[model samples]
Target chain A: MAKKRILIAKPGLDGHDRGAKYVARALKDAGYEVIYTGIRQTPEAIVSTAIQEDVDFIGLSLLSGAHNELFPRVVELLDNKGAEDIIVFGGGVIPIDDFDYLKSKGVKAIFTPGAQIKDIIDFIELQN
Target chain B: MSLNEIIAKKFSSWEKNVLEKLLKKFPERQKEFLTASSEKVERLYLPFENEQEKYIRDLGFPGEFPFTRGIQPTMFRGRLWTMRQYAGFGTAEESNQRYKFLLSQGQTGLSIAFDLPTQIGYDSDHPMSEGEVGKVGVAIDSLKDMEILFDGIPLDKVSTSMTINAPASVLLAMYIAVGEKQGVPREKLQGTIQNDILKEYVARGTYIFPPEPSMRLITNIFEYCSGELKNFNTISISGYHIREAGSTAVQEVAFTLSNGIEYVKAAVNAGLDVDSFAGRLSFFFNAHNDLFEEVAKFRAARRIWAKIMRDKFSAKNEKSLLLRFHTQTGGSTLTAQQPDNNIVRVAIQTLAAVLGGTQSLHTNSRDEALALPTEDSVRIALRTQQIVGYESGVTNTVDPLGGSYFVESLTDSIESEAQTYISKIESLGGMISAIEKGFIQKEIQDSAYKYQKDIESNERIVVGVNKFSVEEKPPKGLLRVDPKLRDLQIKKTTEVKKNRNNEKVKKNLSALKVASSDPNANLMPFIVDAVKEYATLGEICSVLRETFGEYKENIVL
Candidate 1:
C-alpha cells in the first residue's frame, strides 16, 4: 500500500508541541508522509491545510486546556468543507471526561500523555 | 606498585573473572549504558576517571571566582532555597486568594501564572479569549486587575516572580504601577518578570513580536531596570521550558547559556555596560528524574556561565559572574496513570535541585498531569521542597556531590558537550539567528523524538507508564476551573472600561505609540504611564502590534 499521508497540526494558542512533533516524527519513521503545522494554528488554517494537502489523517494536538473548544472546531470545519471522511485524532493533556465527547464529534481516538506511538500506529493501520 | 597501577591490575583481574562470569550468566542489558543525552556511562567511575590535578581549578570554592561549587559560601546553611510555588488561575481576586493561601502555608516567594489571554495580551472580553479567560492562569486586563492581584501582598516585603513573556512589558508596567500604589518605589521592587522572549520562540511559544523587535524590547527592559529597579531581575533566560520541551540536560544548559550570551551582546550593543545589566540576569532550569545528571547539569551551568561572564563579556562585578537559578521539577515527568507516583517523582527531582545548590525551587504537584493542581496537591508540592530543605540533611553541605567521580566526570562531559553546542550556535550567528534558521528547534525536536522512541521501545522505564502498569480508577481532587470565570472576568473588563478615564487612556496609549517608533526611546516609562491610566493589556499591545507588527511563527519540524 502507498504510504499514508498524515497532517499533524496544533490548532490552538497552546505552544506545547512536544507531543505533536514527536508523533509526527514517529509516523514519518513508520513510513507516513507527515505534514506538521507548528504551534498556534487556528481551526480554519488546520482545515484548509488538511483540504489543500488532501491528507488521509489529521492529528490535532493541544495542551492549554483549550482542546475542548479548539479540537472540535477543526473537525466541525472539516465537516463543513465536506471532508468528514478524513480521520481525525486528538492528543495532549486531555482529561478523560472529554474522551467520549471528542470521539462523538468525529475525533477517532484520543491519545493522552505517555501514550505509545506504536498504539497510535496500530490504530491508524487498523483504520485501513 | 603505584596506586594507579595496582588499581588497574585489580580492575583488570575482576573484569576478566567476575564480569565474564556475570555476563555469561546474564548478558548485559545493552552494549553500554547511556544517559538520556546519549553520553556513555561507565559501570564504575573511579577517582582517576577525571584528571586529579585539575580538581582545584574545576571545583572552586563556593562564593569565589569561577563558582563551580555553589554561588554562596554557606549555601542553604545560611538560608533555605525559596519555596516559590508557581500558582495562578481564574480572576485576579481568585488567584490573589491562592497566593495568600500559599504564603500562609509557608511559601517563601510568590510566582504568578497569568492566564492564556493575559499572557497573549488579550482582554478578557476579546473574542479570541473566549473560553480561555482565566483557564491556564490568572487574568489581568489592566492596572485594576493588577491592583486586585496584589491587594494585600506587600510588594517590598515579598519576592514575586511573574511567569509572563511576549507582553512582558505591559505586565511589568502593571506590576510597577501596583508597587507604586503600595507606596513602594521602583528600586524597592524585588522580583523577576520572565521577560525572556528568545526561549518563547525556541521552546514555550508565547512570542508576540518578531525577533529583532523582541530583542529591542528586551534591551529596553535591561536599560530601564538597571537604572530604576536595582533589586529586580530584568530577565530570566530560561532552559526550564526547553528541557520540558524535550531537550537533553546538556542542550538545556547550552541553549540557555547561548541565550544569556545573546542577551548580553544585545544589551552591550545597545550601549549598556555589561556589568550593570548582567548582575540582574537570572536563569531558570527544569529538574528532571536523573539525579546525578541534573546535579551535574547545574554545576556545569554555573562553571560555563562564570567563564562566559569573565572571559567573554568581561564582566567585572562578582554578582554578574554568578549564575543564580530557580528550578521547577519537571512537569512532563508527571504521569496520569498512577497519580500518586508523581509525589515520589517530585521528591526525587526536588532533592536533586536542593543538592545541586539551587537558589530557589518549585515542586510539581502530583495532580498537575490531569489538571491544575488543587490546594491539597499544591500544598504537597510545596511540602516536598520543605522536607528536602529542612529534613533532608543534604542542605547542610555545599555541593556535597562535588567530588563524586561519577558526578565530576559527568559534569565535565556535560560542560564540554554544551560548549560544542554553544560554539555551533555562535557559528550560526547567535541564538536569534539560530532560532530564526530553526537550528535550535530542530535539535530539540530530534532529541524529543529519540526520547519518546526509547520510552516506546521499553529501553527507558517510566514507572506506571511502560513498566509497572496499573489499572486504576481515574484520579480525583484535580482543580476544576469554573467556566463562569470567563463571564465574571468579561464583566469586570467591561466595568473597568466604563469607569476608567477614557481620554487619559487614549493620550497615554498614543504617547506609547510615539515612543515605540523611536529606536532610542525607552518604552518602559511610556508603558508604565499607559498602565497607570488603566489602559488594558490588549489595547497597549494592539498599539504595539500596529507599530511593530505581531510575530507570525515559522513552522519547522
Candidate 2:
C-alpha cells in the first residue's frame, strides 16, 4: 500500500511555526509522507501545489484569528476544481460554537487549542 | 460536551478491550485509582476550598488593590486596545510598503518581524542568510534596512516594536539612528525591542552568547534606555513563543513570569533603579484558545507582577506595579487542513485578547497557517480587532467578567498552581539555571507529551480531528513569498556595504568588540556608534560572537 501523502501549509501573518512544524513531525512519525509548505502561502498557490503534489489530505493551521475567511476560500477553491473528494481537515483556536457551522460548510474536522497529536493521527487514519 | 460523554466517546473502545477485560477477569478487590482528571471532570480545576488563599491577598481590582482583574481599570473603554498586527517580509522596501499599508488600515502601532539572519544578527548578504534571506520576515542588514523600514513613518509619532533577540542591542542602535534620521530626539523615540534572549533559548531556539554575556547585553540596553529613551520599552519579556511551544496556560504563565523576575533582578543588581526600568518593562503573551484559561492566565500574570514589584523589589510607584503587555493570538493553534477555518479561530483568539485586558493586540491572519499574510488577509485581521473594539460591548465594564464566579475562581486556581511552579524552579535554582538544566524545558516537554498522549490514547477528541470526520477534502490557500526576495535583499545589502565607508565601518566594529569583551563594558554606546557609521548587522554580530562565545544548546531532545 502507498503511504498517505499530506500537506501542512501555514497561510497567514503568523510566523510561529512550532505547532504546524510539530504536527508535520507527528504525522511523519505516524508513517505519512508529510510536506510542509513553509510560512506565508496563498490560497491559489496552496490548491495548485496540493494538486501537483497529489496529496491525500491537506492540514491548515492558523493561530491568527483569521480562520473564518481563509478557511472558506480554501474549501471553495477545491470545490471549483471538482477535487473536493480528497480528505481535508483543519485545527486551531476554533471555538466550540463554530464547529457546527464549519461542519455544515463541509469542513471535515477542527482541532482546537490543546488538541492532542495522537488524536489528530487517529482522526487522519480513520478518515483515510 | 459533558465530561462523561467526552470521556466515553474517546475511551469507550479502549476501556472495553483492556480495562473491562481486566475488571471481569479480576473482580476480587477494587483498587482506588485517582488521576489528574478522571471521567468525572475533563479538567480538574482548583477546588473552592483553596479560594481564600489564592484570591484574598493576590487578586484584587482592575487597576488598584492587587490589580488582578487587569492592570488598567477602564481597559478597552478608556481607549480601544492598540491594534498592532505584526508585519514584515521580503526586502526592506517591500516591508516598508507593507508597514505603510498596515498603518493606513487603522493599525495603532507597528510590530516588525525580522528574518532569521537578522534575528541572529546576520546581514542579508551573509552566506548563512542565503536563500532564507527575506523568506520569513524583512531582511535587515545595515542602517539602510532600518532606514527603509521606517522611511516615511515618523518614529516619534508611531510606536514601533521589533521582534529581534540575540542582536537586540545592535538592532536598538539601528532604531535609535533611524529616529535621528527622522529628526526625532533620542528621548522622544518610542517602541520596543524584544531583547528577551533568555526565552529565545528555552522556547524559540534563537540565542547568540552564553547566558552571562547575554544578560550583560540586555542589562546594557536596560541601563541605556532608562537614561535616553524615556518612554520606550527596552525588552518585551515574552510568553508568546513559550506558549507556542506547547505549554499549557499554567506552564506558560509560570515560565514567563519567572523569566521576568530574572530580568528584574538583573536590572536591580546592575544598580539601576527598579522604578526607572521596571515601568518600561513590557510583556508579550500568546492569546491561545481555552478562553477561560487564557483570560485567567492574564489575570494571574498581572497579580503576580504587581506583588513581585511592590513586595520583592520594593517598587514605590504604581507604574512599576503595572504589567502592560502586547498579545498576539496563538499561532501554534492553526492547522494546514481546511484552511478557511482559521479565520474563525483567529477571531475567537482576538476576542480572548480583548477580554483578557491586553494593552495592545495583534490578530494573526488566517493565511498565517500557510504563509505570510497578503494585503487582503492582513486587512481582515486588522478588521477583527476593529469589530471587537467597536461592536463588542464587553469593554463597557472594567474586567467585564471579573466578578464571575467561574472566571474569578479560575484566576485564583491558576495563580496558585503557577506559584507551585515558581517554587519548584526556585528550589532548583534560578530561571537561567532552570533553563540550562532543562528543568523548565522538561516541564514544557512533559506537558506537551502528556497532551499528545491524551489525544493518541483516545482520551481527548479534537472536533474535526478525532470525532467529526469529513469525507471530502477542502481546497487549500497558501501564501508564497516571491522567491526573488532573497536575491533582492542580498543585492541591496551588498550595495549598502559597498556604498558605506569601509574604513569607518572597520574602525567602529573593532571598537564595538573591544568594548563588549570587557566585563564591565556597556555595549549600547559602541553599538550606537557602529549603527551611526553604517556597520552591517553581520559585522556587529560577528564581533560579538568573537568576543563572547556563541551559546550551545544543551537540551537532550
Candidate 3:
C-alpha cells in the first residue's frame, strides 16, 4: 500500500506548535507523507489544503482552548465539501472532558499532552 | 608536590581502587549519563590545580563584575524573590477578581496573561478572534478594560508584568494611562513589558511586523523608557518561550542572550546610551526539570551577559552588567497524567530557580496541562514556592552551590557551549538575519524532535507517562471559559467605542500613523496619545500593520 498521506495543521491563533511539529515529523518518520500548515490557519484554509493534498488524515492541533469551536468547524467543513472520509484527529492541551463531545462531532481520536508518538502511529495503523 | 600533582595522583589512585572494582560487577544503568541537553556527564567532578585563579576570574563574589554567583551582595538573605504568579482569564472584571484574590493570598507582584486576541493585536469582535476572546487569558480591547483589570490595585504599590508582544506599545500606553488615572506618575510605575519580538519569529508566533520595524519598535521603547519611565524595565529578553518551543537548556541561554545582544545593539545604533537603558533590561528564563543543569544554566547566563556587557558593549556601569531575571517553572515539563505528580515536579523546579538565584518566580499549577488551573491548584502552586522559600533553608546563603565541582564544571560547560552557538549566530549576521534564514527555528525543532523520540523509545522516563503508568478517571472541575465570554467582551468593546470621543480617536490614530512612518520619531508618545483617547489595541496595531507590513513566518519543518 502507498504511504498514508496526512495533513497536520494549526487552526487558530495559538502559536504553541511544539506538539504539532513533533507529531508531523514523527508521522513522516513512520513512513507517512505529512503536510503541516504553520500557525494561524483558518478552517477554510485547512480544509482546502487537505482537499488539495488528498490526504488520508487531517490532524488538527490547537492549544488556545478554541478547539471546541475550531475542531468541530473543520470536521463540519469537510462534511460539506464531501470529504468526510478524511479522518479528523485532534491534539494539544485538550481536556479529556471534551473528548466524547469531539468524538461525537466526528473527531476520530483526541491526543492530549503526554501521548506518545507510537500511540499515534498505532492509531493510524489500526485505521488500515 | 604542587596541588595539581598531589590531587592528580590521589584522584587516579581513588578511581583505580574504588571505581574500577565497583564498575566491574555493577555496570552503570547506561553507557554514559547525559544531562537534559544531552551533554555528557562524568562519573565524578574533582577540583583542578588552577582553581584559585579560575575562581577569582570566573566565580567572583556575588554583586560584583561577571555576576556568576548572584547579582546582589546579600542575595535572598536580604529579600526573598517576588512570588508573582502569571494569571489572567475571562473578561477584565473576572480577571480583576482573580488578581485581588491572588494579592490577598500574598502574591508579591502581578503578571498579567493576555488572551490570544490581545496578544496578536485583534479586538474581541474581529473575525480572526472568533471563538478565541478571553479564552486563554484576559481580553482587553481598550483603556476601559485596562482600568478594570487594575481597578482596586494601586499601580505605584504593586509591580506588574505584562506578557505581551507585537502590540506591546499599545498595552504599555494603556498601562501608563491607568497609572495616570490612579494618580500615580509614569516614573512611579514599576514593572516590565515583554517587548522582545525576535523570539516571536524564532519560537513564539505572535509577531505583527517584519524584523526591521519590530527592532525599531523595541528601540523606541528603550529610548522612551530611559527618561520617561525610569523605574520600568523597557524589555524583558526572554528564553522562556524558546525553551517551551523545545530548545534545550544550552539553546535557551544562547539564543536568549543572543537576542539580548541584538536588542542592545539596536538601542546603541538607534543612538541611545547603553548605560541609560541596559540597567533596566531584564531577563526571563525557564526552570526545567534538571536541577543541576537548570541551576548551571542560570549561572552561565549571568556570566555570559556580564562579559557581553563589559567586553562587547563596553558598558561601564556595574548595574548594566547584572543579569537580573525572573523564572517560571517549565510548563512543558508538566504531565497531564497523574496530575498530582506535577506538584512534586514544580516543587523541584522551584528549588532549582531559587538555588539559581532568580529575582522572582512563577510556579505552574498542577492542572495546567489539562486546563487553566483552578483556584485550589493555583494556591498549591503558590504554596510550593513559599514552602521552599521559608522551610527549605536554601536561601540562608548566597550561591550555595557556587563552588561545587560538578556545578562549577557544568556551569563552565554550558557557558562555553552557549558561546559557541552565539558565535555561530554572529557569523550568520546576528539574531535577526539568522531568524530570517530559519537557522534558530530549525535548531529548536531538531532538538524538540529528538526529545520526543527519546520519550517514545523510553530512553527518557517521564514518570506517570512512559513509566509508572496508571489508569484513573478523567479529571473534573478544570476551569472552563464560558463560550458566551466572546459575546460579553464584544458588547463591552462596543460600549467603550460608543462612550469615547470618536473625533479625537481618529486624530490620534492618524498622528500615530505619521509618527510610525518617520524613522527617527519615537512611537511611544504617539501610541500613548491614541491610547488616552480610548482607541482600541486592535486599532493601534492595525495602524502599525498598515505602516509596517505583517511578518510572514518562515515555515521550517
Candidate 4:
C-alpha cells in the first residue's frame, strides 16, 4: 500500500509539542508520510496545511486548555470546506466530559496522555 | 591494612557473597540502572570509593561559601519554604478570588499564570487572540484589568511572581504603577517576572521579539529594578519550562545556568554593576521524581552559580553569591491514566524539592494533566506541601541528605556535566548564537525523544503508565474556564482604549517606539508611563514589534 499521509499539527498557543512530535515520529516509523506544522498554529493554518498536504488524517495536539475552542474550530473549518473525510483526531489535557462532545463534532478519536503510540496507530488503521 | 584497603576488601567480599548470590538466584532487574539525568547508579556507595576530597571542598556547611548544602544557615527552621501555587484562569476577577482563597489557605506567595494572548503581548481584543483569551490563564489588557486583578491585595505584603515572558516589561511596568496606586513605594514592591526569553527560543515558544531586543528589554528591567524596585526580582532565570519541554535534569541545570550567564553578561554590558542587581536575582527550577537526582541538581545549581558569581564576575556582595530559587514539582510527570496516583508522585517530588532546599515551592495538582486544577485539587496540592512541612519531620534539619555517599557523588556528577554544557555554549559564542544555530533545541528534542522512547519501551517505568495501570473510569469534575470570558475581556479592553486620553496614549507609545531603537535608552520608564496612561499592552508592544520585529524559531524537528 502507498504510505498514508498524516499531518501532525499543533493548533493554538500551547508550545508543549512532545506528544505531537512523538506521534508524528511513530507514524513515520510505521511507514506513513508525516508533515508536522510547528507550534502556535491557528485553525486556519492547520486546515490549510491539511488541504495542501493532502493528508489522510489530521492529528491535532494542544495542552494549553484551549482544546475546546481550537480543536472543534479545526473540525468545523474542515467541514465547511467539505474536507470532512480528512479524519480529525486529537489528544491533550482534555477533560472526560468533553470527549463525547468532541466526537459528536466530527473529531473521530481522542487520546489522552499515557496513551500508547501503538494504540494511536491502531486507531488510524481502523479509520482507514 | 589501611582503612581504605580494608573497606575495599569488605565491599568486594560483600558483592561476591551477598549481591552476587542474590543476583544468581533471582537475577538483577536490569543490566544497569540510570537516573533521569542518565547517570549510572552504583549498587552500593562506599566512603573510600567516593570522592572524599571533592566533598570537603564542594559540600561545605549550610550557609557557607559555595552554598552546596543550603543557602540559609537555618534553612527551613528559620522559616518554611513559601508554598506558592501557580494559579490563574478566566477573568481577572475570578483569578483574584482564587488568589484570595489560596492566601486564606496558607499560601505564602502568589504566582500568576497569564493567558496566551497576554503572554504574547496581544490585547484580549486582538483578532489573533480569538478563542484563546483566558483559556490558560488570566487576561490583562491594560492597567484597568491589572487593578482589578489585585483589587484588595496589599502590594507590599504579598510577594507576587508572574510567569510572563516577552511582555514582561509591560507587566512589570503595570505592577509598579499598581504599587504606586496602593501607596507602596517602588522599593517596597516584591515580585518576580519570568523575563528569561532565551529559554523561549530554546524550549518554550511564547517569544515575541528577537534575542537582541529581548536582551535589551531584560537589561532595562535589571537596571530599573536596581535603581527603583530594590526588593523586586527583575527576572526569574527559569528552568521549569525547560524541564517541562522535555529536558534531562542535567540539561535543565546546564541550559538554565547558561541562560542565567547570558542575562548577567547582558546586564553588565548594559553598564549595570553585577552585585547591585544580582542580589535580587532569583531562579525557578523544576523538581522531578528522582529523589537524590533532583536534590543533587539543586545543590549543583547553587554551587555552580556561587562559583560563577564569586570567581567569574568577581561579585563582591555575599548576597550576589547566594542562589535563591523557587521550585515547582514537575507538571510533565503527572499521569492522566491514574489521576489519583499523581498525588503521590507530587508528594515525592515535593519532598525532593524541600530536601533540595528550595526557597519557595509549588506542588502540581493531581488533575492538572487533564485540565486546569480545580479548587479541590488545588487545595490537595497545597496540603501535600503542608504535610511535608508540618508532619514529615525532614524539615527539622538543614540538608538532611547532605552527607549521603550517593547524593554527594551525584551532585558532583551533575555539576561537572552541566559545566561541560555551559562550556559548549560559551564556545558557540554564547546562548543566542547556539539557539540561532538550533543547537539547544536539537539537544532538548533529542533528550525528549530518548525519554519518551524509554517510557514507551518500559526501560523507565512510570507507575500507572507502563507498570501498574488498571482500567480507570474517565476523570470528572476537571475545572473548566467559562467560554464567555473571551467576549468579556475583549469588551474590557475596548472600553479602556475608548476611555483613555487618546492623544497622550498616542504620544507616549510613539515615544516608546522612538526609544525602542536606541540601545542606551532605558525603555522601562516609557513603558511605565504608557501603562499609566492606560495604553493597552498590545499598543505598547506593537511599537516594539515595528522596531525590533518578532522572533521566528528555527524548529529542529
Candidate 5:
C-alpha cells in the first residue's frame, strides 16, 4: 500500500517547529510522505496547505500549551471545507480526560507523551 | 635450544596463538569513534585543577550554602521529584478533560501548554486565531475558557504550571481565579508561571509586547507573587526552549542562566529582596540525548547559579542560590522511523534528568513524533518515569555521575565555556543587547545549520533515518483529530461572546489598558481583575501592545 501523505504545520504564534519536524520525520519513516510548513504559519496557510497537498493526515504539534483554543479550530476548518476524512491528529502535553474529549470531538486518537507510534500508525491505517 | 631461544619461542607462540588470532577478525569488527559527544575528554588532570577544589569551594552538600551536588541533601529520600508531564490540546473543554485524566493517573502536577492564540494574547474568536485554536495546546481567551479548562479539576489539590510567556501574568491571574472559585485560597496555591519574558526575546517566540514593557511586566509579576502568592514561583527562567531552538548544550546553559541573571537584576531594581522571593524562583531545562553532557550541564548550572546568587547578588539565603529545575525530555531527539526507538531515547533522557537531580520531570511520549500521545502512549510515558524512578537504581545516590574525573573535568570545562559566553553577552551589554543586535539569534542559527550540515553529510548518524534502513513498510492507522473541532470551538467561542457580559468585559478591558500603560502597575492584579470580569486574552494583550508596542524579531537566520 502507498504511504499516506501527512502535512505537519506549525500555526500562529508558535515558532517552535522542532516537535513538528520530528513528527514529520517519524511519519516519513513510517513510509508516509510528510510536508512540513515552517514556523509562524497562520491558520489559513495551514488549511490551504492541507487542502492543496491533499494530504492523508495533518499532524499539529503544540508545545506552547495552547491546544484548548488551537486544535479545535483546525478540526472545525477541516469539517467546513468538507475534508473531514483527512485524518488530522496532534501531539503535546495534555491531560488524559482531554484526550477522550478530543477523541469524541472526532479526534481519532489523542497521544499524550510516550504514545506508541505503532498505535498511531495503526490508527491511520484503519482511517485510510 | 638455548634458554634465550626458548623464551623467544614461547613469547612468539603466545603472540601468534592469542593476540594474532583475535587480530585476524579485525577486518570484520566495527571501528570505534574515540571522541565524546559535546566536549573533549580531559585526558589527564593536574593538582592545579583541584587547587581551588574544597568542599565549600567546589562541592557543597545538598540544601547547604552554595548547593551544587543536589538541591536538598535528602533529595528523593525526602520526597520524589514531582512527575509533571505537561499537557493540553484542543479547546479548553477538550484539554480540561485531558488534565483530569492525567490527574487521575497519579500525575502529581499540571503544566498547561497554551495554544498560539492564547499565548500571544488572542482570543479563540479573533481573526488571527482562526483554525489554530487548541491545535498544539489548550486555548483560553477569557475566564469562561479558563474556568472550563479547569472544570472539575480541583486547583486546590494540583499545582499548575502555565508555559505562557507574553501572557503569563494573564494566564496566572486566570489560574488564581480558578482556584478562587474552587475555594482554594490564593495564599495556599502552589504552582509556577513561566513569566520569564526575556527568554521570549532570546529563544521562544510567543512574546507580545516589546522588551522594556515585557521586563516591567516580569518585575510586576515578581513583586506581586512575592507578597500575594508566596508559594507560587514567579518565574521559571528556562533553558528548555533554548535547547529546543537548536542551541548547543552549553548555549542552553549560558543563555538560560544569563536570562536568569537579567531577571534577578530586574527584580532587584524593582526594590524586591532577593531572599524574600528567591526560594520561589524555579528553572526549566531540556534533557537531550547526550547523556554525559546533559548531566554535566546540570551540575554546572547549579554551581554557576549558586555563585551568581552568592558572589554577584550578595544573597545571604542558601535557597536563593540553589537552582531547582524541571526537566523535560527533548522532543528533537525522538525519531519517527522505528518509532519504538523513541522509547529507548526517552528512557535514556529521563535517566539523564534523574541523574542530573531534577526537582520534577516530564517525559515526552514516544509516539509524540506521530501525534498527540494517546492514553496508551501517555501511560507508557508515565510508566517510563515510574520505571526509572522505581526500577532504576541510579537514584540511590545523589549525583551518581559526579566524582568521576571525566565528569568533573567536563563540568569545569562547561562552566568555563558558559562563563565565556556570559562574558561575550556581557561584552555586548547583556542578553537584551545581544538580542537586539541579533547576536544570540545568529549564534543559534549558525549552530543549527552546522548540526543540520553534519546530519546531511552523514557525520552525525540518526539511526533508522540516515542509516539502518528497514525494508518493511511502517504499520498503518495513526491517531487523527476530528474535522468537527473547529466548528464546535467557533460556535462555543461565539456563544460565549454573545452570552457573556460584554459591557463588563469592556469596562475591565479599559481598566486593563489604563493599568498596562502605567510603568509602576502590576499587570497580574489587573489581569486578574480583567479575567474575573471576563475580559478576553486578546483584549488584555492588545492594551499592552498598544501601550508598549509590538516588537518585530530581527531574524538573522
Candidate 6:
C-alpha cells in the first residue's frame, strides 16, 4: 500500500511547536510521510502546501487561542479550492467548547492536549 | 579499614543479603526507576566518607561565597518568595481589571504576559496580527495602551515583571514613561524585563532581529540600565522556556547558564564593567514533577553560577555571585484529561519550588493546558503558593534539604553534568554559535521525542494520560478572547497615530533608524524617544527590521 501522506502545520503567530513537532515525528515513525510547516504560517500558505504536497491529511496545530479563526480558515480555503477531500484535523491548547463548532466546520478530529500519539494514529488509520 | 571502605562493604552486603532476598519474593514494581528527565534513580544514596574539608569548600553557609545551601542567611524566614502570577489576556482595559483583581487577592507581584504580535514587535493592527490580538496576553501598541495597562497602580509600590523580548527596550521605555507620569523617577522603578533573546532563538520563537543586532540591543540595555534604571533587572536569562520546549533539568541549567555567559561576554566586550551589570542579572527556571531532581537543579544552578562569576569572570561584588531566580511550575506537565488533577500537580510543583529556595514563583493554573486560566483557577494557583509559604513548615529553616545525602549527591551530579554541557557549548564558540549550528535545538528535540515515546510506550506515566485512565466530559468555562478585540485595538492604534504629532513621530523614528545603523551607538535613548512620541510598535519595529533585518530560524526538526 502507498504510504498515507500528512502535513503537520502551525498556523498563526504562536511558536509553541512542541506538540506539533512531537506529533509530526510520531506520524513519521508510524510509517506516514509527514511534511511539517514551521511556526507562524498563514492559512493560505498551509492550503498551498497541502495541495502542492498532495497530502491526504492536514494536521493543524495552534496554541495562541486563534484556533477558532485560523483552523476554520484553513478548512474553508481547502473547500474553496475544491480540495475538501483533503482531511483537516487540529490540535493544541483548544478548549473543548470549541470542538463541536470546529468539527462542524469540517475539522475531522480535534485533538486537545494530553492526546496520545496512538489516538491520533488510530484516528488517521480509521479514516482509511 | 577506612570509613569509605567500611561503608562500601556494608552497602554491598546489605544489597546482597536483604535486597536480593526481598526482591525474590516481592519483586519491584518496575525493572528500573527514572525521573521525569529520564535520569536513573538510584536504589540508595549513602554518605560518602568525605573529610570536613570538602564540606567547607563545596557546601558553605547561606549568604556566603559559593552559596550552595541558599542565597540568603534567613532564606524564607526573612521573606517568603513573591507569588507573581503570570496573567494577561484580551485588551489592555480587560487585562488591567485582571491585574487589579490579582492585586486585591494578595498577589505580591505582577508578571505581564504580552500577546504574540507584541512579543514579535508587531502592533495590534498589523496584517500579520489578524486573529491574534490579545489572545495569549495583553496587547499594547503604544504609550497610550501602556498608560491604561498600569492606570491607578502606583509604579513604585509593586514590582512588575514584563515578559517582553526583542522589543524589550521599547516596552521598558514605556514603563519608565508610565513611572514618570506617576511622579516616580526611573531609578525608583522596580521590575524586570525578560530581555533574554538567545533563549528565544533556541526555545521560544519570539525573536525578531538577527543575532548580531539582538546581542547589541541586549548589551545596550545592560549599559543603559546600569547608569539609569539601577534597580531594574536588565535581563532575566531564562531556562523556563527551554525546559518547556522539552530539555532535561541538566540541559535547562547548562543552556541557560551558557546563554548568561554569552551575555556577560558581550557586555564586557562592549566595554562595560562586569560587576556594574552582573549584579542585576537574574534567572528564571521551571519546576517539574520530580521533586528531588528539580530541587537539586535549582541548588546546582546557584553553585555553578557563583563559581562562574568568581572564577570565570572575576566578578568583585558579592551581589554579582548570587543567583537570584524566579520559578514557574511546569506548563507541559499539566494534563488536559482530568483538569482538576492539575491542582494537585501544581501543588507538588509549588512545594518543589519553595523547597528549592526560589526568590519568587508562578504557579500554573489547572486549566492552562486547555485555555487561558479562569479566575477561580488562577486564585487556586496563587493559594497553592501561599499555603506552601505560610502553612508548610518547610520555610522555617534555610536550605532545609542541604545535608541530605540523596539531595547533595544529586546536586553534585546535576552540577557536573550541566558543566559538561556548558563546556561543550563553550568549545563550540559559546551559545550563539551553538544555537546557529542547531546543536542546542537538536538536543532539546531529541529529548522531547524520547519523552513522548516513553509516555506512548507506557514506560513513563502521566496521570490521566498514560495511566489511571478515566472517562470524563469536556472541560467548561475555558476563557475565550473576544473576536472583536482585534478591531478595538486596531481602532485605538489608528486613533493614536491620527492624534499624535506626526512630524515628531517621524523624526524620532528616523533618529532610531540612524542610531540602529551605527555599530557603536546605544539604541535605548532613541527607542525611548520614539516610544514617547506615540510611535506604534509595528512602525518602530519596521524601521529596525529594515535596518537590522529579521532573524531566520534554523528549523532542526
Q: Please tell me which predicted candidate would have the highest lDDT against the true structure.
A: 3
At residue A50, give the lDDT of candidate 2: 87
Which pairs, if any, clash in model 6?
none
In model 3, where do residues sit more than 4 Å from their true spots? none
lDDT for position B551 in model 1: 83
**Cα lDDT of model 1 by residue, B261-350, tens digit:** 999999999999998899899999999988999999999999999999999989999999999999999999999899989999999999
Cα shift from native, residue B89, model 5 (Å): 0.9
Ordered list by TM-score, greatest first = 3, 6, 4, 1, 5, 2
Supply the TM-score of chain A against the true chain A for every candidate structure. Answer: 0.97, 0.93, 0.98, 0.97, 0.86, 0.98
Give each prediction's DockQ, rounded to 2 decimals: 0.66, 0.05, 0.84, 0.69, 0.16, 0.79
**Pairwise lDDT winner, candidates 1 and 5:** 1
lDDT of each: 0.90, 0.78, 0.94, 0.90, 0.78, 0.93
Candidate 6 chain B lowest-lDDT run of ten: B46-55
CAPRI quality band, candidate 6: medium
lDDT of 2 by residue, B226-258 (tens): 899998999999998888776788888888889
3 or 5: which has the higher lDDT?
Answer: 3
lDDT per residue as tens, model 3, B1-557: 98889889988999899989999999999998989878899988999559999999999999997889999999999999999999999999999999999999999999999999999999999999988888889999999999999999999999999999889989999999999999999899999999989999978899989989999999998988888999998889999999999999999999999999999999999988889999999999999999999999999999999999999999999999989999999999999999999999999999999999999999999999999999999999999999999999999999999999999999999999999999999999999989988899999999999998888889999999999998989999999999999999999889999999999999999999999899999999999999999999999999999999999979999
Cand. 1 Cα-lDDT: 0.90
Considering just chain B, what TM-score does every model have?
Answer: 0.98, 0.89, 0.99, 0.98, 0.91, 0.99
Tens digit per residue, CA lDDT, model 6, B1-557:
98889999998999999999999999989988888898888888888677467679888899997898889999999999989999999988998999999999999999999999999999887777988999999999999999999998999999999999999999999999899889998899999999999999988999999999999999999999999999999999999999999999999999999999999999999999999999999999999999999999999999999999999999999999999999999999998888889999999999889889999999999988888999999999999998988898999999989888888888999999999999999999999999999999999999999998888888888888888979898777888899999999989989999999999999999999999999999999998999888998888889999999999868888
- Candidate 5: misplaced stretches above 4 Å? A1-11, A17-128, B1-37, B42-56, B472-477
Model 4, span B1-557: residue lDDT tens: 87788888988999889988998899878899899767899988867444567667898789988899999999999999999999999999999999999999999999999999999999887777877889889998999999999999999999999999999999999999898999999888898998989988877789999999999999998888889988888888899888988899999999998999999999898888988899988899999999999999999999999999998899999999988999999988999888888999999999999999999999999988888999999999999999999999999999999888899888888999999999999999999999999888888878888888889998899999999989888777778888888888888888888888999999999999889888889999999999999999999889999999988768677
Writing each residue's lDDT as its tens digit, candidate 5 over B388-444 gives: 888888878777876766666677788889999988998999888889998987677
TM-score of 1: 0.97
DockQ value for model 1:
0.66
